[model samples]
Target: MAGYSRWIKPEVYPLLAPVGAVVGLMAMQLVRNVYTNPEVRVTKQNRAAGVLENFEEGERYSQHFVRRFVRGKRPEVMPNINKFFSDPE
Candidate 1:
């Protein structure tokens, strides 16, 4: 513990507990999902149904708020810089 002070900063100590708690919660949820979630327990009979479900999920995710907003905008890399250089004086 004493040697840890030399490697880890004192400022970071407060952040460690919250980060550990979040990681612990995520791990517990993962375990619970593995045992109780139907999506995890796929069978040969319902494999096609699972594929359809996945496709629908994909469509929903693709139509997400952020994706919808960005989709309407131009697909540009550094549009401002390009505009500035492209402008005629």
Candidate 2:
């Protein structure tokens, strides 16, 4: 332990101390930006809205197809051809 401390004192600590402080401050700033930045919040909200809009569009298209073809009854055979190639195991 003493030898490790001695090795750290003059060689490692002086070089690492300031770098560590700067890195710590940078990490704190990054966390603060993620938590408090308005631009980041708006971008996140826009991305979420885009995703939700895409999902709703897909749902509406599927519903329209189901209403047209399947009506109120379930299909006897699966409509998708790709299901045959899928691994059952």
Which runs in model 2 stand beyond 4 Å of their true positions?
1-9, 42-46, 49-89
lDDT of 1 by residue, 1-89 (tens): 98988999989999999999999999987886665455665566755565344666556544766778888677888988888899956
Ten contiguous residues minimizing lDDT sum, candidate 2: 36-45
| Native-referenced Cα lDDT, model 1 | 0.73
lDDT of 2: 0.62
Q: Distance (Å) between predicted and true CA of 29, model 2?
A: 0.7
Computed on alpha carbons, the lDDT of every model, listed in order, comes to 0.73, 0.62
lDDT of 2 by residue, 31-73 (tens): 8566554334456556575434355645554466437776865
TM-score of each: 0.43, 0.38
User: RMSD per prediction, one decimal?
Assistant: 7.2, 17.0
User: Candidate 1: which stretches are off by over 4 Å?
Assistant: 42-89
